[model samples]
Target: MKNLINYTVVLLLLVFSGCSEDLESVKYDDINPSIFPSSEADVQAIVASAYYPLRGSYGNGIHSTSENGLMFILDATTEILQGPYGVQQEASLHSYKASSTSFTRFYDVFYNKISNMTLSIDRIEKSNVNEQIKKKAIAEVRCARGLLAYELFDLYGPIVVAPLEVLKNPLDEQPLARLSNAEMVSFIENDLKAAAAELKSPAETPYGRFSNGLARMVLIRLYLHEKRWAEVEEQATAIMDMNYYGLEENYAGLWDITAPVSSKEVIWAVPADYAGTSENQWQLMVLPNNFPGRGGYGTIQSSWKFYDSFESTDIRKMALIAEFTGTDGVTYNRANPANYMQLGPIPLKIHPDAARTTALTTVDMIIYRYADVLLSRAEALVNKTGTPTQAAIDLVNIVRRRAKISEIELVNYATLAKFNEMILLERSHEYWCENGQYRSDLIRHGKFTEHAIDLNGAASQSEPYKALFPFSLAKISEGKGKFIQNQGYN
Candidate 1:
């Protein structure tokens, strides 16, 4: 009576089917048994494990419920999010070192999953599963690997990615070197290209899975970072031509508890539930312990500088709580902050879950959405043309209209630099705590360290070379002589 429709349950079945009752009969010298891809159903289970790295758990996933979430760390380092805690302040002030545990944790956790995807793809291709099934499975896993690779590359330049043949040998003690920058870019580009060819289109793709549009969106991001203007334009335009995505009518409703997983605006979102399959604990991070109806840990807050930058009528700021009356019957605001509200305003990025509940909410963790595409294309157009164009201005207007803010004028952003500055601000306002790319946006514009110093003063310890974080001493030691640490770190 067991159902195989759920891939997580099938993963358990796959594991147990390969296990032996008598442990002594198993050979230690043998590689772990590959018991997958004999059927189309098995391929689904195999790829499901690849999706685990993208979940909203703690350390195991990128969109984690805690401070370990990549977006949380990325935004905390920028002007978007801040707090008085050691790690949060260290991130905000740019005082973290190679020894900092938070910056060091990502490489090992995600690189191993990339290796697992390599093994899964190898197995799926070798098995007798339908050719169509094998193609889709490999594409899904590759998209996952490509996305994970992009995240690690963004954080730490290049990373050690073992080949399938090397992954096939479990007994070998190989210490691999990180790929060169060009090599790393090509590696990610190839995976995404292959995946885009085989994955379903946005309308055809199921609720939480990767679509061809998502693959192209990640490619656009990579191209943007590398300043490959033409390529960025090409990819962003391709997603737009799909005609399947748009701006959600309500900017804040996208994060509402009743938000649909199938929203046309969302390209890729982590389908979260209260059952702990995937979690969203942002409310718990920003809401104060004495918040009226629902209290939280009072861990972090949005900066006043960021709050003041928004136009008074901007609807996006509705999600940010500048004042609130606590359960203690005392109102807290920026001028007279209580113990919990000292840093700034609460960045309640998502709506408060009114239903009786724990810290976790059912609101989906939106990783990539169409608003990003529209804004990214606008940046690309201006950068590609070397001047602001009306075409680009219209794209920005689409997102602005949804924000209920007035449209910006094309003439206002005449030069390339001026247009990019506006695009960066719009991107920050649109994606602040959602995707965490604001740090990269700042770094891309050469404003990351400057912004840190401008906000935090001398305590920032902001350095030019510190743009890419340092590789931990432990990671360097583990690589033996083959690994080279990032610059500006021991």
Candidate 2:
């Protein structure tokens, strides 16, 4: 799949050269609708362009494990991450403003891609290609569009989505309004549902490409966000019925350098390499600058509170580093305060690439996995029943058992509120640095601001209105007073 990605990238470049002029009178090899997307590979190149922004490049991909990526930006706003830098500190304390580029950049990057994907899908559907190929190709683009839309919507509510007709007429000066909550939900839901119907199973899909399971997983997340318990249950169960996925026996092996591409546990992961379009530089971002065997800038850390939340026997905590020997022959720990230890334990969720000579590593960036499917179903079941169900507890226990922790008896969480609390904590521990959905989980449960205030006291700028991030001032200005900033922000 990685090699196929490289080929598609080269094809994309060859097909769409920005330097070209005279589109109508271009050479035979030049990109003309009649000349390009003329074959299956051409259709792939068109679809690949939509997938480009998902690569692990800083300020480019939503899946990037780097600070600029959606994972870091979203996770920084939760208990899983803490740092003393500009955006990191702001996100950690819920002090971000509309102008904070870290939060606003996603809108600028992905909103345009939605339009591009829409255009790509339209072209693929109108092409004279094989109907079956067109169906799958169009489905791929829709899945990418839906995934990107859901991501942006999760960060900021109800994004401004131009209609396909409006997109086709790019020169028109039609200013579109942000979709209503219902419209946005329906729009994203429709795209994902369509994609899921046509997309292949995980076993049939090329690694890193969207699969039916991935599309359904996004639906599950969307359903969870909307508190649509029944839909979440249905979507999760659908993935389970596929019977192609399950939990990996070893939790830590999920992120091994030579990650198991066929690991049934992984529903979707970005195929990465030291030298590839997708880069995984997590170790460089979190490792202390002077660590014994390796080197890193030591940027982000997980709070000691979060680390302490895990049971001592939890195998998941093995990834969080609390102590390390510096090159100066001094061991840095919480007791012996150091620059890195001051914030908290290093959230080295991804294993350190010991053989790496630079920041990049080949660890595949996991986006969604089967464990999430289990937890989502458990949470949805409890929410749907409005009480702790034995089945829900069993599902939660499945994940806990993998974490090497004692199972919580149903008697312990008899109330709906109590079960939700337990499930939220379980999600935080189970999915800390993976995809940053934990922030959404916290917000959905109305604990986002509460947890910040509880942990940081007066320092926390968290407010109930901060449940949704603010739109950029520029976006508002572009709206010419039509777009209202999120409540509470100026």
Which candidate tops lDDT?
2
TM-score of candidate 1 against the unseen true structure = 0.93
After TM-score superposition, what is the CA distance of residue 165 in candidate 2 from its true location, in Å? 1.0
Q: Candidate 2, residues 388-441: lDDT per residue as tens digits? A: 899999999999999999999999999999999999999999898988999999
State the RMSD for candidate 1: 6.0
C-alpha lDDT (0 to 100) for residue 29 of candidate 1: 22
- Record all residue pairs in model 2 with backbone atoms less than 3 Å apart, i.e. clashing: none
Per-prediction TM-score, please?
Answer: 0.93, 0.93
**When superposed on Cα atoms, how far off is each prediction in RMSD?**
6.0, 5.6
What is the clash count for each candidate, in the order shown? 0, 0
Quality of model 1 by C-alpha lDDT: 0.80
For candidate 1, lDDT tens digit of each residue in 251-306?
Answer: 88888887566689998887676656467888788788888878889888888888
